[model samples]
Target chain A: MEYLSMLPGPTNVPNRVMRAMLAPIINHRSDDFVELYTDVVDKTQQVFQTKNDIVALSASGTGAVEASVINIVKKGDKIIIPVNGEFSGRLAELIEAQGAHVVKLQTPPGQNATFDQVKEAFDNNKDVKAFYVVHNETSTGTMVNYLDRISDLTSRNDSMYIVDSVSILGGVNLPVDKWNIDVCMTGAQKAIAAPPGISPISVSPKAKKYMIANPPPTMYFNLARYFKYYEESKHTPFTPALPLLYAYREALSIMLEEGLEHVFKRHKVCSDALYSSLSAIGLTPFAKQEDRSISIIALNYLDGLEDKIFRDTLADKFKVLVAGGFGNLKGKVFRVGCMGEVNKYHVMRTVSAISSTLAMMGYKTDAQAGLKTAEEKLKAL
Target chain B: MEYLSMLPGPTNVPNRVMRAMLAPIINHRSDDFVELYTDVVDKTQQVFQTKNDIVALSASGTGAVEASVINIVKKGDKIIIPVNGEFSGRLAELIEAQGAHVVKLQTPPGQNATFDQVKEAFDNNKDVKAFYVVHNETSTGTMVNYLDRISDLTSRNDSMYIVDSVSILGGVNLPVDKWNIDVCMTGAQKAIAAPPGISPISVSPKAKKYMIANPPPTMYFNLARYFKYYEESKHTPFTPALPLLYAYREALSIMLEEGLEHVFKRHKVCSDALYSSLSAIGLTPFAKQEDRSISIIALNYLDGLEDKIFRDTLADKFKVLVAGGFGNLKGKVFRVGCMGEVNKYHVMRTVSAISSTLAMMGYKTDAQAGLKTAEEKLKAL
Candidate 1:
């Protein structure tokens, strides 16, 4: 049974993208692969809205995030990470693992770090090497709404601005170049609608310069090696996951064909519909209105509604698979992904399924009202 | 045109394995994913022939090798790596990147590090932390044939025995437990015939203890985190490449169904055919017969045969893709993969293709004789 994936990532891959995986494997060093890889990288740069070189890594999103950190942050380097959710907190830990002194600007799980908070962190810390932040905190369904504003502080301080846009990039407007983002990493499975595994990360020339000067003592996650290989042969340093590359190329083509404006607008409509519909069904939105994620929709569990039972019922009965919360929010919030190939049909079915599941769990919810609300919002798509 | 992949890795994925990737994405934390992941790990362990725990990392073969090295070798740790081929040399570099003192046992290309040479290294270096070797060096088509014996040396010295069996595990008999290999890593694409990306690595209890005692400062490649996640739920530390996992599971299923003994025998017969046929066509085998890789057959280019022109003719004219030699052997040798789904038909087709390509290049070669030789050897399969 194929349950609808409504989790934050590894979302419902479109048939076009999934079918692309059926293409025969090709030699990564071959001309055909060079063409496929170059095209994928170019399309990835377009989606990132950056002129920076993109490296398609054959690892998960976390690997790319690690690459972004280990490449720039050396020992004793002070790096500021605004931790608002599980993903951001993990990023801080990853930086600390590099022997860097992480100055974390802690925020409540449901809220994002404001520009003022980050600016103050920059002011407090001297010679900060980098500012790392998760653009979209999938765990809490919160997004930093002030990244464009915060980029200014990093720019003024001359610190590398690294953004983990794993859950947001293709679905949201993240202009890496405009924001002066030195490194922006994203997973293929998220808004890109490709299969999981490949993470296409955009690296600015500044970041590349820093990395080449102080190369990480790593082989597989070494960004400098990727740059060298890309420059020399339009190839990854290692054998890439060829099928995922194919799927990613196709997914990016779909995104480009629809136009980034339309893709971002569709994501906005879908997430809006989810938020409004779930809110109407007596489920409170987890994040504050101003900071809610436009990709992952997080909702507080209704009073007396069991978390496992609710999700289980949704999966087993409705075949709609949603995610329970992570860390502190576990059993308190449920997350539904509104990114990646999500359309009016998906939004409507998800709203109806949640409504029906909650009602089945003996919660007071109007299924018709939820569906109508979702239908109205999705009309924008 | 879909050229047949005969490279050392990213081999021709079977249609069943490729189609398995079309399965819709699922939540990594879900029970369904747990089932899928657990089964894949179990089958991977079977291929590895190990009773140890297997960590299926969502990275390439090199990433797994990096994980194995970084997890165990701390700063200033002395690790002996035999450098005979490109892969082994890279392994030494990865170990060195971890700030470990790499004592390289340098052997010429197309030759394996003898048991005596490794023993000499261990004797000379006191308190050696580990002994790393590439079981099948794909770049030079050479394999260390004394791993079982070398494992004893590491066991006696209480050093970790790490083996990079990335290109040969499924198609060859590598009993990790029997050989006392502390860390054995293999990629899914090579021999396993799954699409590349996921690298399933087996860790013995001893290696795990050492890793837990001295954890690497890494997030994504952290083996400890993987252990914790697998213990809590049959899940990886982060989101896995779901479609690749599906393909890996199907590929493993095919391997298990065929039985390891039969698989190993088939690989032996296939390589035997390639060796006899290609040798008959006047292309000398690059690796000495004693140390040659059974999975990757490396043959020297005939005198006056241009490497690019020969391989191009093979690819364009006959729709067969083979690899050129690496490093010093570039343009000197050609490699054909005789692993995974490679049977009598592929053997005959490849032999005929090579012979005809050589003939087309104005070289003296008997295509009929090569085909007949391949047919005679493939009868064993």
Candidate 2:
């Protein structure tokens, strides 16, 4: 049985993107593959909104995030990472694993790191080599709203500004160049609406120069090799997931064809619909209104509702798959992803499914009210 | 136009395997995903012929090779690697990049590392932490023939035995358990016949214990995280390339369905056919007869035949894509891979294409004779 994927990511891939994987595999070093790779890099740069060099690594989003850290920061260097959600905590761990000193700017779950919090950390740790932040916290359904401001602080301090925009970039209007984000990485499976496995990362000239001078002790995730191969022959240093790349290119094409502004607007409208509709059905939005993510909707379970039973019922009975919160938020909240091809029909069906499921579980829910709210919000799209 | 892929890697994916990727994306943490991941791991073990735990990484073959090195060999640890061709040379580089002292067992191209060469290195480097070797060198189409013997040496020395069987695993018989291989990694695109990207790596208990005791500095390629996730949740530590995992499982299913013995025999027969037929058409096999690989057939270029012109004609006119030699072998030899769903038709067609392309380039070649030789060898299968 096919179920709608409402998780933060691996979001729903379109038929056009999925069908693109069926193309026969080609030699990665051949001219045909070079053309394909070049086209993908070109399209990827447009989506990233940066003139920086872009490379698609055959890895998950986490791999690219790790690459961003290891490629620039040395063993003894100090780096500041803000921690709020599970993904942000992971970012800290990744930096710590590199033997670098990570000054984590701690924030409460459900709240994003404030500009003041980042400024204090940077002031305390004066010799920071880099400042890494998760643009969208998938676990808490929150986003760092002041990234443009944070970039300015990093630029003034001469620290590399790295962003993990895995689940948000395509859904949100993130102009990497305009924000002065030195390094930003996103997954193909998220808002890109491609299959997972390929992470498209954009590296600014500053970051590239640093990496070349102090090369990371890595072979596969080596960004220098990627740049060399891209410059010499438009190809990846190692064999890439060919089918996934094809799907990624097709997904990017679809996003471009629809226009970035329109896609971002669609994500905002759909997510806004989810927030209002779910709220009308007696579910509380977990994150604060100002910090809530536009890509994922985090909603609290009704009183006395079991996490597993609720998610299982929504999946088994209603054929809708959402995700439970991570770490401390596990039993408290469930996340519904509203990115990557999410439309009015998807929002309506998901709202209807959740309300009906709640009603079946003996909860007092106004299903019609929720559907009406969703319809009202979606009409704006 | 659909061309027959005869390259060493990114081999032609079977239709059944390709169709497996068309399944809609599911929640990776769901029971459905767990079952899928568990099934793929189980089938992967069967192909590996080991009771060791297998982890499918969302990386290419090179990434897995890097994992094998970084996970086991620590900084300042002494390691020995046999460098005969491009891949084994890379193995040495990966080990050295970890701040480990590498004692290279140098062997000439087109020649497999002799058992004596490995033994000498082990004797010279008494405190070696690991012994790494490439089972199949894709660049030169040569393979280490005495892996079982080397495994005995590694066992006696109490050093980790790591093998990069990327280009030859499924088509050749190198039982992981029987040979006591501590860590063995292979790619999906080679003998496995799946699309490139996912690498299946098997880890023995010994290797796992050492890794847990002294963890690697890397995060993305961390095997401990993979073990914890697999044991507790039957899932990967991070979001995997879901479609590629599906393709890998289907490819494993196909390989097991064909039976390992039958698959190995098919590979041997096909390579033998290519060797004999190409020789009959006046081409010399690059590797020595005893050390020649059963998966890839490397042959020297005919005199006065331009490398680019010859390969382009073969690809454009005959619609058969093979690979040219790498590094020093470039423009000197060409390679034809005979693995992963490579049957009578592919062999006969490749042989015919090479001969015809040679004849078109004003070199004397017997196209009919090459086809006849391939037909005779294929009749045995």
Candidate 3:
């Protein structure tokens, strides 16, 4: 089967990036390698949209999140987190693991935490050291206005703002510097158009101050040592995934050449086309229309249709892989990602495939009309 | 200039494996992925020569080593470790980080702890929970007779025998069952012919018993969880690196088809050829002859000749990478790896490159003669 990965992670990797990852592994100590590492770091700062100290760790996204927690929050620190989606809830668990107290601002599954709620929590808890939130929740297709609300909350309290932009980073217009985000970190798999191995983290000076003041006595995720090593030697504390770094350098080059604004615009257009097609097929979106993420669009199945059957038909027949609604909404919706290299053509094909698959699975829908409407919307762009 | 990476790891990745690794990013949950991971694990067991529970991790070698330490050793366990080379010392450090006390049996560099020494240490330390040692110390090019020693140590002591085979697995024969090695683990980059990311680890029933009795409180590196997941679902605790696992499957297929015995003999031939050429060129092998590893050859340079300059000449002129010594042996010795996919032909080419580069630097050797001797040695096979 000709399979296309429309899943949230391990997204469509570019051919050039694939080749770059395949390139011969070079000696890490070589001068050529140091130059490569330095170039990647500089380019990463541009992608992150921040002048903060960006350190690349050869770990999964979860590892970087753990590093953020371990570096800034020592034992018994009070941290504020949200329990909106899976990733946010994961942060709460990580905070708990660090032996820290967590004050969770709970919102409904599809809804995001409001600034007023966050403010109330902050006002109630003066000992909070940091605020952790996900900018775009992958489990739900809700895009929080992190820069507008969370930044205000953290700035008012003088606490560190740690944002996980993992699924939305490269595809969204996240001006990290303009937003005053203290710690913005991302994984490579989602909008980065690369393999899932490395995590890119940009630490604000304020966050760095907090990290240095309370450096975790850990070894693998030692942020202070990582900063020293990257700044002084352009290397990591241990042997990194060298091939993945090469892949990142290539992926970043392509991303920068396309410009961040163009990438963001593309994601919005593709996602809009997908949403339009779903609407044409009489399917409602899971999240509020205004808060739908540009990179991922979640479509709720009609009353009689099952999401698993719809997804299985798409995968087994059309070979278009997409994300199933996670957790509470498990069989209710399917998510189609328009991030990274996913463009208008892909969006149209996905819409057509879903429409046809739904029809084959005994759901009433004019499959061609969904595809035609999607194409028209995309062409009007 | 030709360059050689002789420093322990990020060892030379073969072009075939690198090309294999250049595949498109794959979805970890896909059924196609199940086949890849199963193949990788099955082949890894073949390399370890055991039917133990083998699991692959999407982290560096140290990360897996950390997994071993945290999985087996709880907070108050005592470990008996051989502190001969840098890697074994690292094992002790990892164990100590778990709040365990290490009883070290120290041996000098270029030497291995004798069986009597290990047994005596275990005999003296009645509370020892585990005994850790590196089968091949890449830092010192010293290969121990761990197989002959581990069986007696663990069979009677009721203690785990954990072998760090990071630099030696697949390059040498590791009979885990015959050797009674409770746990044997290795990384991808060393002699596995794959780029580094995943660490392959196999554990025996005895090690499983220890884990069941004392489970580490950590969630990430939980071995029992991994075993449950693999035994029941044939999956990992978290999302595994699909691409690296694919590379491992292919590399292992090649290794097995080539025959393990043939592969070991080839490594011996390459190592001996390189060692002979170094001797002919008036350089001394760093490791004692009786205990020298057949995978990596460490050579001492002539007095007053900086090892970096010689390494630079090799890299710049020949496009070959040799390793420079680390820590105490820096600037004094160069390491030439004969491990993994490296064969006699590669050794001949490297030896010729070394002799030619040295001759140009006025080191007085017939480059063509050294090349001829190395070629003759290979032709004899």
Best DockQ goes to which candidate? Answer: 2
lDDT of 1 by residue, B1-381 (tens): 677778888888898988888777878888888889889888888888888999988889998988988888888999898898888888888888778888998988998778888888888886998888888998889977787787768877878888899999888888989989999999998898888999999999988987888888888888988898888877888888889899899999999999999999999999999999888888789998899999998888877788899898999999999999887889999899988888888888888888888878788887777888888888897
Q: TM-score for the second chain in candidate 3? A: 0.93
Comparing candidate 1 with candidate 2, which one achieves the higher DockQ?
2
**Ranked candidates, highest lDDT first:** 2, 1, 3
Q: Report, for all candidates in order, the number of backbone clashes.
A: 0, 0, 22
Clashes by residue pair, model 2:
none
Tell me the fnat of candidate 3: 0.38
Off by over 4 Å in 3: A209-218, A327-329, A366-369, A376-380, B1-8, B209-220, B366-380
Identify the leading candidate in terms of lDDT: 2
Local accuracy of candidate 2 as per-residue lDDT tens digits, A279-379: 98889999988999999889888788999999999998999999998889988999999899999999999999999899889999989889999999999
In model 3, how many backbone clashes occur?
22
Supply candidate 1's per-residue lDDT for B9: 84
Q: For candidate 3, what is the lDDT?
A: 0.78
Give the alpha carbon lDDT tens digit for every residue of B20-138 in model 3: 77666666655667777788788888888999988787777777787788788767788888877777877787788778888888888888778888878878987778888888887
> Model 2: runs farther than 4 Å from truth?
none
Worst 10 residues of 2 chain B by lDDT: B149-158
TM-score order, best first, reads 2, 1, 3
Better of 1 and 2 by TM-score: 2
RMSD of each: 1.4, 1.2, 2.6
* Native contacts kept, each candidate: 0.91, 0.86, 0.38
Better of 1 and 3 by DockQ: 1
